[model samples]
Target chain A: MKLKILKSYLNESIQHVSKAISSRTTIPILSGIKLDASPNGLTLTASDTDISIQSFIPAETDGKQIIQLSEKGSIVLPAKFFVEIIRKLPAEDVEIEVRPPFQATLRSGTSEIQMVGLDPEEYPHLPKVEERKVISIASDLLKTMIRQTSFAVSTSETTPILTGVLWTLTNNELKLVSCDRHRLAQRETPMETVGEQQFGNIVISGKTLNELNKILPDQNTLVDIVVSDNQVLFKLDNLLFYSRILDGTYPDTSKLIPQNFQTELVLNTKQLVDSIDRAYLLSREDKTNIVKLVMQDQGSVEISSSSTELGKVTETIPVSRVSGDLLRISFNSKYMLDALKVIDSEQIHLGFTGSMSPIIIQPEGDTKILQLILPYRTTN
Target chain B: MKLKILKSYLNESIQHVSKAISSRTTIPILSGIKLDASPNGLTLTASDTDISIQSFIPAETDGKQIIQLSEKGSIVLPAKFFVEIIRKLPAEDVEIEVRPPFQATLRSGTSEIQMVGLDPEEYPHLPKVEERKVISIASDLLKTMIRQTSFAVSTSETTPILTGVLWTLTNNELKLVSCDRHRLAQRETPMETVGEQQFGNIVISGKTLNELNKILPDQNTLVDIVVSDNQVLFKLDNLLFYSRILDGTYPDTSKLIPQNFQTELVLNTKQLVDSIDRAYLLSREDKTNIVKLVMQDQGSVEISSSSTELGKVTETIPVSRVSGDLLRISFNSKYMLDALKVIDSEQIHLGFTGSMSPIIIQPEGDTKILQLILPYRTTN
Candidate 1:
């Protein structure tokens, strides 16, 4: 394969694909990035056993030449060294030529580097997805949904299905739910679908979603997602992200969220976040990470935590409004902080059914994003 | 102790002293930072037995009150949590009050944090150095000297003295030398002395110098350095840094550098560095980190490295001048890169004493900095 491409374009594409190349892969060729140069464009692909990523640089982009190809061929080069060398090459354009017997020479400026390449035929091919079952969603909204729910996915491998975020689609409404037993996060949004085929129980690994989020552009570009029997493909711009779906049904988290609350309070999100963060330091030292919030009748809340060796911390933040009964509840501060950070609102509404029941949090007027944290039982 | 200090001033002072608080120290009290509040100012000190750093914030500076002290006392607080808490406090001024039995309450805005503190008497006191044997040097030059020579210090503790930089003072010139057997770096600068003591062979650990370098101001402030029997004290403005000197006579590295050369080359420092850096990548794959430089009579040098499995790389960078006999020498590219990064010159002069002898590097027309790297023996 002989091709000349801009350094910046290649560097960015390599960075995107490198995220899928795992160092612990058992297959030798899986650790290398497969490059395919054709008359139309140049494509780079990298995969581990679970996920695959491919980025394409067209021959011409917006009237400017992005890649110049003299021959069409394919070769696989070690991702580790190739990525680092490409980033440090001291030239604007890099020329790559693959000779027989799998020898690739990369030339840029006064530097010429020759690296051994593997046969591209040994690399795994991307799984094909049905085009008719594709669903399109805005990239910006998809990233937000991933950020809001992915953190709640269980990191423990004991329950494999719980390590993924469940994606459910009913007609036009799309719902994402992630639960780690201790806490849960769910986000619902309206998306455009191709047909009246309602999709559900499609669980993608939270780690995979995070990688997809990083490569997705921040703009409002449309991303088409196609789900096969066991694999899901996300197509954005000239990039394709494919991941294997977890086998097994996700637990129903809908029953965990309560519809009504015995106590409710609305407060400034920044103030509450800051107060809990300070109290968290002491709670972390106690090894319980438990912070108590005591709601006052006069529209104020006291947040406090104590450690046997580090003393205690107490912070009082005024609430904008209060209703129902006054209550004191203890919960993990880290869970609360994580939920508060993703709620994009100045004021947040917090609902508590009781000290032992799960607490619900939502943006003041938005019902699309909901966070639930289980309270810790303590003898106070 | 009761005092109200500006958050920024307190935070900066805490940061400086916290460097000396080693988390792995065996002494329990050594992990805490000692805070002393007097009528004059507030002092923060942290020690790790080997090194001690103290930063003082005066009650008033430039006619503005920096610390308001209502009571005079001292206490030791846990450095890890205290430093992080001070940085995140949401107030311009923080009020700290100490109760009986070393209970400290820190109040800022609506947040109040009570932390258990250790008795100040249990903390190790800073070592005293003789003021009569003191020398003065510019802070910026000292930092430069540390940077130029510190990287050559032996990280292996087999020879403790080799892990420290040898500080020699003759007349009014200060010379610092560091070597790790393979390569050596020396920097010389002129400084003023309090007396004609003409001190020599004061070795301070490279690790201690690195911490001192981090706290030194960038400006040309004068720093007073006092050398005692086993301790070196550096006094800069309101800060005091004390470090234990390594015991043993440093080896003489003067004979290692050659005054005569069989080959000479003058080239752009950045160009040679970039060329060697690229070659280093390939050499690293071979597990030797060895790159060869071939001097051409046409005023150009070819840098190359090869790996049996990963092929090879060759880069030819043009030099402005070349003299004496043609030469081909191999050396560790990392050592060459490290030395080149510290030279303060655009063009560098390289002197080679045959293919096996050590190569001397100096900034063009400057004698203040000298770097020597040993050549690797190759069959070719």
Candidate 2:
């Protein structure tokens, strides 16, 4: 294989594919990146059994030439060294030539580097998914949905299914739910689909979603997502991301959210976030990470935390509106802070069913995004 | 103690002192920062035995009030939480009040934080350094000198003195030298001393100097350096930094540098650095980090490295001048790269005595900075 490509284009594509190359892969050939050169373009593929990524650089982009190919072949090079060498090359264009014995030579400017390559046949093949059940969404919107709910996924491996976020589609609405038993985050948005097909119970590992988020462009580009029996594929401009779906069914989290509240308060999001953040500093020393919020009839809330070694902190933030009954509730400040950060509205509505029931939080006038947190039982 | 201080001033002072608070210290009280409020100003001090830093915020500066003190007392608070709390406070002005039994209350806007404080008497006091031997230098120059030589210090604790940079003063010239048995970096600068007092063999740990560098202001302010029996004190405006000197005589490194050379090459510093950097990537995989430089009589140098598994890389960078005899030398590319990054010259002069002798490097037309690296013996 012989090809000449722009250094910038190759560097960007290498970065995207390297995210899927795990350093601790058991298969020796899995640590390398497979490169295929054809008349149309050059493709780079990397996988780690659970996730696979492929990036292509066309021969011509817009009116400028991106790659010039003289021959077509395939080879697998160690991703670790190959990526670094390409990034540090001193020239604008890099030329790569592969020999019969699986040896690749890369030349740029006055530097010439030769690296051993493995046979492309040793690499694993990517999983195939049909495009029949595909949905289209803006790349930025998908990134936001992942960021808002992915953090709530359980990090514990004891329950393997909880480590993934559940994706459900009904009619034209798409919902994502992530729960770690202690707290839950759910985000819903309207998506465009090819056909009127309803799908549910498609659970994807939160880690895979995060990697996909990093590679996705922040611009408003359309991304096509295809869901199959046990595999999902996300197709961007010239990139493809595939991940294996979890085997078990996701638990129903809708019942955990309360429909009505005995107490409700609406306040500025930043002010409440700052108040709880300060109180969290004190509670962190106690290791319980518990902070209490006392709602008063005067339309103000007292946020406080104390530790035996490090005194205490109390903050009073005024609420814009309050209703129902006055109550005192204790919950993990980290969970509250995480939920507050994802809310895009200036003001947030926090509702409490009772002292021990789950608390519901959402943007002031938006019902699409909802966050639920379980209260901690404490003797006061 | 009762005082009202500007949050910005308090936060800056706390940041400076917190650098000396070591989290792994055996003494529990050493993890706290001691705050003393007097009629004149508020003083903050933190010590970790090996180093101590103190910052003072005066009651008034530049005809403006910085602190308002109603009462005078002292207390020590955990530096970790105190620094973070001060940085995140929502108000411009912060009021701190101390009650009986070392309880401190910090109030800013609607937030009130009460933290348990240790008795100030338990904190270690700073060492007393007499002004008998002191030297003055520009803060920027001192930072540059440290950066140029500190990276050469030995990180292994086997030789404690080698882990420090030797500071020598003679004839109003300050010199710093550091060597790790393989490579050495030396920098010298003319200083305006208090008197013609010559001193030598004062070694300070590289880690301490790094911490000091982080806190030093970038402006061209004059810094006072006082040397005692076993301590060195650096005074910069309202800040004082004290560090313990390593016990032992530093080895003489002058003999390692050669005055005459068998081959000489003058080339662009950046070009040679880039070429060798690429070759280093290949050598790094072999665990030797060895890169060979062959000076050609045609005014060009060839840099190359090879590994059995990961082929090789060769780069040819043109030099402006070449003299003496053609020579080939191999050395650790990392040491050469580190030394090149610190030289403040676009053109560098490289001198070689032979294939096995130490090579000398200095900035073109500059005599104040010199670096020496021992060449590796190679079969080719």
Candidate 3:
């Protein structure tokens, strides 16, 4: 491959693909980013079996030439060196030339890097994700949904399917759900679709979703997601992200939410968070993260946590409203804080069925988001 | 102890002293911060046996009442919980009351924390650093001096004294030197002395100096330094930092910088640094950091590094002046980069004694700072 490209564009594309190149990959060619230059443009592809990312830079963009191509070819260069050197290139334009037997030289200003490139033919081929059942969603909305739900994914390898967030689409609505043994988070949003399209049981690795989130555009552009039998593709502006779906079936979490609440209270989100945070500091000392909450009379609630050696912290804050039976419950304060942080509301409504039941929380008057945490059975 | 103190002021002092608290300390009492509240002010102190820090918040400062003292007493609270709780206290002013047997209750707004405090009597007492010699220097200048030399200190604990920076004050000048065997960085500046006062071989741990640098004021206000037999005390506006001097004689490093040179070159500091930086990235892959420098007869220098498996990177930049015979030298690129990064100059003068001799580098037309790096023996 022989081409002269703008350093800025080249650097951005390299970074986009570099995220898929894992340093721990056992395969030698998988540790590199494959580069292909042709009449269409320059495409950079990297993969580590589970996830593959490809970013492209056209020869010309908006009447301005971004690349001057002398020949069409393909080669795979080690991501480690290429990423760093391209970022520190001294000039505005960088020229890359590939000679016989997979040898490439990158020249910019007075600097020249002669790197031993791997044969691109030896690299793994990207999974062909046919555009089967494609659905479009706004980037910002998808990013928010991922943030709200992915944190609850199980990190244990014993339950492999639970390590991914389950995605379901039906009737132009998209929903994402993640649950560990202790806590569960669910976020649902409406997606605009021209036809009746539906897909379910699409479980994507939470770690891969985080990588996609990093490259997701901040703007309100549309992202098309294509779901196949076991492969999912997220198409962005000039970029393609492919994530493998977990093989096992995801557990049904619908029955986990309680249909009725014995006690519910509406409280200021930040105030409750701050009070729980103080109690959390003490609870963390014991490594139990057990903070107790008692629904008090006259629209008030008490939060407390104690360490056997560090003593106790207690605080009472006024709630906007309280209904049904009063109760005392204990739960993981860290999980509560995480749920409260992502709730985009000034007031949150918390519901409890009994002392040992899961605590249900959602933004006041909003049903689009739900977070639940199982209470710890403490022998008061 | 009973006192009502503004949360902001109390939080600031706690943070200042918390730097001295080490969580890994085997001693339980050393993990807590001692609080002494008197009619005059409230003092917070923390120590880890090696270094101690004290911060005082006056009862009133600039016509503002920061503390309202109800009684005078002292107690030690676990730094972990106290620091975090005070920071997230629910009100602007927090009231702390200590009962008999070191049980303390902190009240602010509607929050109450019952903490089991350690007896102040059991806390380690701060060493009295008698003022045998005192010198005043701008806080910014001292911070810069620490940053320039401390990076050269040995991180390995084998030679314990090499982990500290040696301080020498004589002839109305203060000099700081740090050497890790392979490289040495020295910084000096004239000090205003009323009398012929001098101190030498005051070696302070580089780690402690780094902690002290965090709290140093950014302004050009003068900071008082008191040196005693075994300790050094730094007095800031309202903070006192005490550092234990390393109890060993420092090696003589003055002769490492050669007075005469076989080849000399002067070049733009940024350009040379940039060229060397690119070479360092490639050299780092080999884990040897061995980058080669070749001086051209026509006032240009070539910087290159090669990996057996990854190939090579080469860059040449022009120098303003070149004298004597041209030479080729190789050294650890990381050490050279560190030495170059600390030099505060636009133009740097590099002097080479021979292929294997130490390379001397200093700012052009200045004798205040000198850096030396030992060259590596190479077959090619």
Candidate 4:
């Protein structure tokens, strides 16, 4: 491709596509990012086997010329070097020219870089998705949902499906759920959907969602999502992200939530987080990450953790409200801290059926989202 | 020890001493920070074999109570846990009490931590330095000298003495030098000395100096330094740093720098840095970190680097002045970048003796500091 493009525009698009270029790609051609220049603009694409990202730059943006094209052509440059070179280019405008035998030259101010480029035709084409079930959600809302639930996904690859967050659309509402055996996170929000259109059991890798979150707009804008049988596509303003869906049925988690609680407590979210965070410090030393919480007769909760070599940390925080049977529960403090951190509420409610059962936590006055952690069975 | 201390004061002191408590410390008692509380103040000390740092928090500072001593005693608490706990404590004031058998309880807000304290007597004492010949220098200047020279210290342990920066003081001039075979960095500044007080051959570990740099006052206050037979002591406002000097003699690098140049060029430091930085990126890809600089006939220099697999990057920068002889030299771009980054000058002069000799770099009009790098032999 022969074109002169603004450094800022090219740098932004390169950063977007670079996210899809994983170092683990075994195919040599897949390690490169493909560039296609046309009469309209320039398109940059980067992909591994699992996910692909493409960003487009128009000939002009907001009445300012961003690109001047001399010829329409295509070539693939190594993502690792190209990404860094563009960022460090010494001028506002960069001129890129491709010669025969796939050699590319990039010139910016006093710097010129000649790189060996690969044939764009050899790079794999992006998967085509049927746009029948296109759904749109606000970018910031989607980012928040990803942040809330994605951390709970199983990091282990043994059960690959469990490594993804399950996405389900029903009754004009979009819900996301992720569980990693020890803890589960779920979030739901209302959306305007076309008449009676509904789909479920679409699972996308938590890691992919995280990368997608980074590319999402910082401002509140809508992002359209298209789900195919085996692939999913997220279309933002000028960028497109495509990923393969996990091919397995997600476990039924509806029954995992306890319908009633024998014990319940409500406290300021920051105070509770502070109390448990201290316990987590000592718990992390023991390597079990176990922190214990016990209800007090004087309407307070005692949060504590002990290490065989380091002794113990005990935190006493008064509860705003308390009811049901007295109980003592132990759990992974790291998991709880992760869950509590995403909570936006000033106060949170905790529900427990018993010591060993799952403890349900919900933001105060918010019924659409919750987090659950399975308590550890401690002899004490 | 029983005391109520302001968390901010205690936290700052803890951070200063914590630098001496290395995780690699083999002695259990050395891993703990020794705390001595007296009517005057609370003293926090941490020591590894090579270095020891002590911070004293007075009972009152500037008419405000920083430490309220209830009883005078001493104890040693595990540095790893105490450092983190104090930082995350829930209150501005932290109360610490030591009971019989060396059990300590720390109370802050609603949080309480019970730690097993080691016997203070078991902790190794800090080295005693002879304070007969004490000289003082600006803390910021010492910090700057450390930053400029420390990075060149040999990281490899095969030559243990080379891991230290050599310090020489004579006629009110304090100079620091470090060399790791490939390149050498030297920085010198004049300080007021009392009656011919001079010391040379005092070498301190670069790692220890780095730790000291972190604890040095951000303001440009003077730090009294005492160089003893085997230890160097640095006295800050309320902090004391004692470091053991390397036993072996440091190699003389004075002869390595050329007294005259075959070719010389002067250019804007930032522009030269940017040009070479881009070349360094490509040089880094080749893993040799080799970037070549060639003097042009038309008052300019060319910076370039290449990889067999990735191609080449060339930058041509115009120089303001050129004199002596024409030359083409190659050196480690990373070393050049490190040396150039510490030059606080708008323009810098480059002096080259020949294609095979060391290239010297100095900030324009500054003779107090200089950097030297050996040229690499390359067939082109």
Candidate 5:
């Protein structure tokens, strides 16, 4: 294989695919990025047995010759070194020549690097998918949904299913749910489907979702998503991301969500979040990071936290309305803070059941985003 | 003790003193910051046995009332917690009231914190010095000198003295030298001294110098530095830093630097540094991170490194002139790159004694800074 590609174009494509390459992967081949030079352009791919990423650089872009391909073939190069070399290469064009005996030579200006390349046949191929059974969503919406709920996914691999965010599609509505047992975050968005098919309980690892978010741009254009029995594929522009699904069944979490509220208070999200954050400084010395909220009948919410060893803090935030009865509740301030970060709306409604029950936080205008937290019980 | 200080004013002073407090210190009192409130102003001090920092916030600054003192007393609060609390407090004015039995209350608007304060007598007192010997220099230049040579100090405390940078002042010139017996960096500057006292040998820990760099502002203003029998003090503005001097004689490194060169080359400091940095990607895998430079009298200088397991990289950098003989040498690329970083000049002169001897890298225009690197012998 022989190809000459513009340094800038190749560097950009290599960066996108390099995210899937793990330096310490048990599989040695997985640490290398697969490069295929064809007439269309050059395709770079990297995978770690869990998630795979493939990015394509066209032969020409904006009247500039990006790639010149000769004798199309494929080879795997060390992902980390290849990317670093491309970024630091002094010249504008990088020439890659692969000899038949598994030797690849990369040259830019006066610098030449000869690396031992692995046979492309030994590398895993991109997962194939059935096209018709796919859903489409705007890239911006998908990124938002992942960012909103993915943080709640359990990082511990003890329960593998909990490490992934559950993606469900029902009645053209895509729902994303993530929970670490102590707290839960759920987001829903409108999705378009070509065929009338209901999809539910597809577990995608939070790690892969985070990597996908970095690769996806902020454009509002629609992107295709194909979910196979064992793999899920996200197709955007000229890039494709394929991730293997977690094999276990996700626990049903619908019953844990509260359907009604005992007391509801609406206030500016930023003010409420800041007030709780200020209260968090005192509670941080404790293990639970518990901060208390007391709703008053006079439309005021008093935030307070105390550490027996450290000090105590109390702040009052005026609320628009506080009905039902005066109530006080406490919850982990970190969980509440994380939930507040994803709420984009200016106003947010917080629903409290009791001092010991789970409190719900959601944007006032939409039911699509919801955050639940189990309150800490304190003997006042 | 009762006082009201502006949040920002107190926060700034607290930050400077907090640098000396470490929670992991063996002495429990060292983890607390002592606050002394008098009719003059408020003083905050923190110490960790090795270094002590104190900053005073006057009752008024720029003719504005910043700190209102009602009563005069002293108390010590947890440094880390107090800093965070004051930083996040919402109100502009923070009222601090210390009651009997070492209980302090911090109130800002509706937020109130009651923390357990420690007795000020438990905290160590600042060392008193006789106003006999002192030296003054630009704070910015002193900071730069610390940055250039501190990285070369030995991190291991095995030798104890090698972990500190040696300061020698004589003939109105201050010289700083640091070496780990592998690489050495030396920087010299001119200063004014109060007495005709010659510094014999004083070693200050690199860790203390690093912290001082962070706290010291980068300005041309003069900083008063005084050294006693066992302590070094840096006085700037309203802050005072005192660190215990290492108790040992520093090794003489004068003979280690070569005075004459067998071959000399002047090149763009940035280009040579960048080339070595790129070459480091492959060199890092080797045990010594060895990269070879081959000087060609007829052509460019070749930079290459190879690992038996990984492949090899060969890059050439053009030079303006090459004298003496065609030389080949291998050295740790990281050390060379570090020396280049400290040069701070556009053009650098690399003076080589021989293939196995140390190479001196110095700025083209001045001899104020010098970096010496020992060459490594490559097995393969």
Candidate 6:
């Protein structure tokens, strides 16, 4: 394979795909990125069994020749070192030529590097999924959905299915749910799709979701998501991201969500978030990172945490209202903070059933997002 | 102790001294910052045995009222936790009150923290040096002197004295020298002093010098350097830094630096540095990080590195002249890069004796700084 590409454009494409390349995996071929040259453009593919990423640099970009294909072929090169070399090359243009017997030469101005390449055939092939059962969503909305709920997924391998955020799609709305038993985060967004076939639970790993989120540039571009029996694909303009779905049934979490609360309060989201964050610093090193929220007799919420070794901390934020026996509940401040970060409404409503019951938090104006935290019984 | 200090001013002073507090140190009391309140201001000090830093927050700064001290007393509090709490406090002014039994109350707006404090007498006192045998130099220049030579100090503790930079005052100049046997960096700057003593030498640990450098803050203010029999103190404004001097004598490195060379070339410092940086990437994983330079006959320098397992990289940089016969030399690229970073001049002069001799690099117009790197004898 022989090609000429602009250094900047080529470096960016290489870096985007390099995130999927495995550094210390058992499969040595997965550590390299596959380069394929064709009449249309040059495609780079990198994968680590769990997720595969493919980025294409078109032959022409904005009237500038990004990649010129002299000979069409494929070769796999070390992902990290190749990207670093391209970034540091002195010239604006880079020339890559792959010779027979697995040897590739990269040159830019006066700098030249000869690296041993692996046959592209040795690399694992990404599973190809038919596009019949596909749904489209705005890339920006998809990224937001992933970021809002993915953090709540359990990282433990004990229940492999819990490590992935479950995606449930109806005819018009797409729902994303993730929970780690202690807390739950759920987000729903509008989707444009044809046909009314129910796509049951497909647990896509949170790790792959995060990686795809970073690769998708923040824009309003639409992405087609195709789901097969065990593999899923996200297809963007000239990039394709594929991942294997966990093969287990996700636990039904609907029953755990509270249907009613004795008291509810609405307050400015940013103000409440800042107060909670400041209170968090006092108990960050504790095992559960628990902080107590006291519903005062007056219209104020008192946040407090105490450690036997380190002393106690107390902070207060004025709330809109208070009722129902002045309840005090303790929960992980980090989880609450994470939930607060994803809320979009200017005002947030928090509902409490009792001291030990799970609390519900939702953006005041949005019915699509819900956050639930299991409360810990606090004496004071 | 009782005082009220502006959040911004207190935060800065606490940060300046906290650099000397090591959270994982064996000495428990060393992890705390000693705080003293006086009628004039409040003082904060933290130390980790190797280095001690003390900074005073005066009653006023830049037309802003900072501290209001009502009582005079001292106590020690956990440095890391206290600094973080001060940084994130909600209010603009923080009120601190210490009561009997060593309990400190910190109040910032609606936030209140009650932390257990240690007796100030338990904290180790920094050695006080007399100001009579002191010299004054520009703080910026002193920082530069530390940066230029500190990286060359030996990190290995096999030779404890070599881990410190040797500081010598003579001929109205303050000279700093550091070497790890493979390379050496030296710099000298003029200073004003009162003592007529011809010579004095003190080896200050590189670690201590680095911590002191961070607190110096970019300024042209005069910094007083007081050298005593056991400790060295740096006083600038309301901040004082004390460091223990290494007991053993440092070897004389003056003779190791060549007085003359057979080949001399003047080149743009940035260009050479950039080329070396690019070439260094190819040899990063090698034990010696060896990169070779071949002075071509036709005003060009060839930089190359090869690995048996990995591939080979070669690049050439065009130069002004080639004085002597074609010469080849190899050395650690990291050492060369470190030396290049310390040079501030745009143009530099490189002097070489032969293929195996040490190479001397210095700025074109300044005799104050000189760097030497030992050549590696390569078989290739």
Please state the CAPRI-style docking class of candidate 4: high
Across residues A1-380, which tens digit of lDDT does each residue of candidate 1 receive?
Answer: 89999999999999999999998988999989999999989899999978999999898999999898988899999898899899988899999999997999999998999999999998887887777678888899999999999999999999999999999989688999999999999999987666676788999999999988999889899998888889999998889999999999999899999989999899999999999999888788777899999987677899999998988899989999899999999999999999999999999999999999999999998999999999999998
TM-score of chain A of each: 0.98, 0.98, 0.98, 0.99, 0.97, 0.96
The numbered model that scores best in lDDT is 3
- Looking at chain B only, the TM-scores across the models are 0.98, 0.98, 0.98, 0.99, 0.97, 0.96
TM-score of chain A of 6: 0.96
Which DockQ values do the candidates obtain, in the order shown?
Answer: 0.78, 0.83, 0.82, 0.88, 0.69, 0.73
Model 6, which residues run further than 4 Å from truth? A323-325, A378-380, B195-198
For residues B1-380, could you state the per-residue lDDT of candidate 6 as single tens digits? 89888899889989899999887899888889999888778889998888899998888778868888878899998887788889988889999999997899999988889888999988887787876678888888889999999999999999999999999988888899999999999998876667654456699999889988998867888888888888999998999999999989899899999887888777777778877777788788455589998888778888888766557788887875446557788988989999989899988888899878999989987888999999998886
lDDT of 2 by residue, B1-380 (tens): 99999999999999999999898988989989999999999999999989999999999999999999999999999888899888888899999999989999999998999999999988877998988998888899899999999999999999999999999999888999999999999999987666588789999999999999999878789999999999999999999999999999999899888888888889999998999888988899899999999877677889999999878999999988888988999999999999999997999999899899998999988879999999999999
Considering only chain B, report the TM-score of model 1: 0.98
lDDT of 2 at A35: 97
lDDT of 4 by residue, B51-91 (tens): 99999999998899888888999999999999999999999
Per-residue lDDT over A281-315 for candidate 2, one digit per residue giving the tens place of the 0 to 100 score:
88887888999999876889999999989888999
Tens-place lDDT digits, model 5, residues A1-380? 99998898888898899989887899888889998889989989999888889899999878888898877989998777788878998789989999987798899887888888888899987888777568878888889999999999998889999999999988988899999998999998876666766788899999999999998888899878888888999998889999999999999999888887888888888888887887787787776588988887677888888878776778888897666667888889989999999989999988887777788999986899999988877777
iRMSD of all candidate structures: 1.1, 1.0, 1.2, 0.8, 1.6, 1.5
lDDT of 1 by residue, B1-380 (tens): 99999999999999999989898988999989999999999999999988999999999999999988899999999888899889888889999999989999999998999999999988776887878788888899899999999989999999999999999999888999999999999999877666666778899999999999999999899999988999999999999999999999999999998989888889999888888888998889778999999987677899999988778888989988888999999999999999999998999999998999998999988988999999999988
**Cα RMSD for predicted model 5:** 1.7
For residues B192-268, could you state the per-residue lDDT of candidate 3 as single tens digits? 98688999999999999999999998889999999999999999988999999999999988877788888888999
> Order of all candidates by DockQ, from best down to worst?
4, 2, 3, 1, 6, 5
Error of 1 at B104 (Å): 1.1
Instruction: Give the TM-score of each candidate.
Output: 0.98, 0.98, 0.98, 0.99, 0.97, 0.97
Candidate 2 chain A worst ten-residue window by lDDT? A190-199
Q: Comparing candidate 4 with candidate 5, which one achieves the higher TM-score?
A: 4
